[model samples]
Target chain A: MKKIIAGAAYVVGDAIDTDQIIPAEHLVYSLSDAEERRYYGRYALSGVPQGQQGLPYGDRPFTAPNAFRSEYAIVVGGSNFGCGSSREHAPFALQEAGCAAVVAESYARIFYRNAVDGGFIVPFESIERLLERVRTGDLLEIDTSLGKLSNRTTGEEFLLKPLGDVADILKAGNVFEFARQAGFMPA
Target chain B: MTITEKILARRAGRDRVAPGDNIWVDVDILMTHDVCGPPTIDIFRREFGADAAPWDKEKLVIIPDHYIFTKNHHANRNVELLRAFAAEHDLPYYYDPGTPNYKGVCHMALAEEGFNLPGSLLIGTDSHTCTSGAFGMFSTGVGNTDAALIMGTGKIWLKVPETMRFVFEGSLPPYLMAKDLILQVIGDIGTDGGTYRALEFDGEAVYDLPVHERMTLTNMAIEAGGKNGIIPPDEKTFEYVRERTDRAFEPVYGDPGARCHSVRRYRVEEIEPLVAKPHSPDNRATVSEVAGTRLDRAYVGSCTGGKLEDFVAAANILRGQEVAIDTYIVPATTWIGEQLHSTRVEGDTLYEIFERSGCKLGQASCAACLGGPSDTFGRTHGSEVVISTTNRNFPGRMGSKQASVYLASPYTVAASALSGRITDPREALV
Candidate 1:
């Protein structure tokens, strides 16, 4: 895991589902192909309603026009982030769009598992709802080791919930690596 | 321990289990559809070596249901990918398109093909895999990485989820369907109310449902962020499984004193016909509250509502009336489609009723449910408003982010089709 992740925070409200993260239509593209996969990045959070795309102010696009990646490296969201489908494309889309980590109050189970187990993104649970506290495009820094977030824009510091047993898998880089290291499979 | 824990314990070779207990259990079945199958197969080969065979091909069921009828090259390639993988593995349970074995929509097909035996730990690569829980099994959805790991190891470690008991007292009313009961639960509990927990259905009304209807209850467990929806196996369950598959399964039951993290009860008669408004399944309102709301389209399909029984409900309402708007009737599987020809209701075949009512019937597949490709049948575009029997009303779920979708039971959707508005079924039924 990176020691520090610093970038502009893109915030959203609760129940930001998989469809909004990456719509089902874009899922037809291949995730294995480096070129084709960028569509996932291009369409990241494309399904979120125009008004809910960015926090504080509505209608803020995650990525620049026609760009494959977003400027934001960290996402601050409310509860039940990634709520709908079991699609791993949800997290993969964030990663494809250059998002390194997400800080939400809570997460849907499958999305949390996919984020952690796939090693696509570090899903950090904030101690409290951060969307209201942080604004979209607000510069923020996270100390991954300490599980702490610092709002560079507001000078507010908050503690995040520990990753627990999942951190070990995250450290190993993915579930397959962790499984092999744990002697569950042949390395 | 509840039945979910008991079933997990039996597979883990333990006497009992509880919430938050992580144990590795052997998978009786690992089901995958076209959408996730290719990626899973790719990861399996990457991790387990390109030449390594699956842990058990027979236990791996591949049904190419999603994106089957699309003209998109990528979508077609996905089905071909599944076909090639099944060919290389010689998997016995591959439901390939263009063949007699083809079955549409993985969830309902799983039940129809007898893969949904009670007490079995069935995992699929679709969120609605919980639909199989109707047969008294432990089934849930997973992503590609975990699915690939199980594909190679035949094992998965699941944290035991605390059960949330939802009981519906009194008998099911004439105008209501299982969809209404589940919708009411989601409305009460919110979407994340059951997050990381098992949502178990109980009480008189639940048991009164036929096996197919019971699936409607379990199908949307994910809509409320549930780990899985389960019901204790009873004679109705056993009889359903027995007729489907002769495979011996020792069904487990919850202890009488088993405790749940939370419990909610409702009297079926008191609940009105419900419809979840646009944007979320938990954004629910009674049908009458939203009645007269104009609708441009009405859809009745997907694993949650495309069963033979679901079609019957729709057919009953559309039997003698001309629809006021565009209505789509897509069966979940070809078998169900065939049954439409064979199953008669009120002196006419369901096919005859639907066709005569000016409804456009579609081929058996997950058409427009996940908004696959541009030309998907029944998919919405622009700002069209739709009321559908399928689960999920999140933006773009049916194709257009601009479009609005209302989730309701087949009866409500059918009745709404007649008036081009969100009308309560009681108005049409009575």
Candidate 2:
């Protein structure tokens, strides 16, 4: 796995829960065949406020139809990201949506584990200052090997926690795959 | 070491284990419900080969509770998948819907069926799997892949969590319930305060609470980011388990000098009814702080609030009074609904109370808690303001993003339903 990746950031506020990531009404699609699972990515941030008056990014959905062109490879969040529910679909949706990493001041424990176990996306823990240093469209660079996050746009840099075993899991493409490599599963 | 440490150390076959130590341990039971089960089965078949069988069929319990009663094709398909999987696998513990062997919510049904034995390590696909910890077991929720992995290997790797002790003293006030106490704790600790930590609840108030009420405390630990919430077993736990199952088990307890990461105390006498306002479980406030707020709906049901005692509390308030707002009452299990039909309080059965108050009674399943399909009864639609007994109040939790949800106790919800506003239960009790 490459230790460094850079892209535009999609910023969200605190306590963005599983319900918002993917509502229960859409869970049936999650159980469908592989082709249908893309709906999870399509509706990743469906619950996020869009086109609401007096909020940031008015009239623009978080992940618009042209989101691939916008290229939000990273998601930055405030405290307690993924706070409710143990659904892996939260991270699955983000991974399907082309999000490579999530940097947050803090995260719900279950979400962190699901991200690692599924090897869906990288989860980074940053200080509260990171939220202030980066904006929605800011080009940010994260280097997991060096535990550093550099803001390519502003030339500012911040520190990130090391990935530890999580990097190995992601390199192996998920826990089950890693288990097979480590001889925990049938060869 | 704390009780959690002791249990983990034993299961991992270690002399001593501390927080942050990752070790693989054998699981006693694995629970999966309709919504999460299909994906889990998919992963199991995909990863382990379609010809592979479960490691232990008896240890895997599948209950179709979330989308059972709904009319949606997809929702019903999830159940059908589970049913076919159970039939193919010959799984003995599968609780089918609309059958004599059907159970209610997986958490409560696990308890009623004696799967919540003390000193056991239980995992479920649903977040409220901590509800089993009320029986002195080490239980927590995991994602679909982890559940499927356990279904294949019957073992999982877990990082040991540090323990936080919360002691509650003094007797609870008449109107104050366990729901208020947990909401107060979550508010104080913030949503992520207990991240990767075990919450050990003790003290006079917790011990005095009924087993059902104690289950409420453990059930909400996940809301505070707890790995698991546990209560030491006592006579109440033993009697409850004995009545449900004849299985013999030893109870685990924390040592007197157990090392704790932090210790917090609360006085039950000083506590008051509380509510988690719209959009967040930690956005808590006193019922008085938001009193007289008009409501369009009042819902009482879920693993957190749909127990027999919860219905009894609401019945006490709605017996003679007519509901001013649309009220939905759902029992957590079929047995609870049957109890409502067979038992009477103050010469009026719970069914009669629902009839007299014009409340819509629902089957024993997680009806409106997860914002079921469009046809699901009592689901919030449009911009209606609702007072619910369900756990989460996040946007679109019950149904519509335009709707606002306030989480409270059954007493508070019932009282509010009577007046079409958020009224404290004490006023109704008076």
lDDT (0-100) at residue B247 of candidate 1? 76
Question: Candidate 1: global Cα-lDDT?
Answer: 0.92
Count clashes in each candidate, considering only residues at least 3 apart in sequence or on different chains: 0, 0
lDDT of 2 by residue, B1-430 (tens): 8889888888888888999998888899999998889999889888999988999998999988988887788888889989999999899999999899999899999999999998889999999999999999899999998998999988888999999888999998879888998999999998888999999999999999999999999999998999999998999999999999887888888789898999999988998899999988889999999999999999999999999989999999999889999999999999999999877879999999888999999999998898878888788879999999889888989988889999999999999999999999999998
Error of 1 at A16 (Å): 0.5
Model 2 steric clash pairs = none
Q: How close to the true structure is residue A140 of candidate 1, measured as C-alpha lDDT?
A: 95
- TM-score of each model, in listed order: 0.99, 0.97
Computed on alpha carbons, the lDDT of every model, listed in order, comes to 0.92, 0.87
* Tens-digit lDDT track of model 2 for A57-127: 54444467634222578888878888888988888888887788999888898888898888778889895
User: After superposition on all CA atoms, what RMSD does each candidate show versus the true structure?
Assistant: 1.0, 1.9
Instruction: Determine which window of 10 residues in candidate 2 chain B has minimal summed lDDT.
Output: B372-381
Candidate number of the best TM-score? 1
Instruction: Output the lDDT of residue B370, model 1.
Output: 78
User: Which segments of model 2 are wrong by more than 4 Å?
Assistant: A51-58, A65-70, A181-183
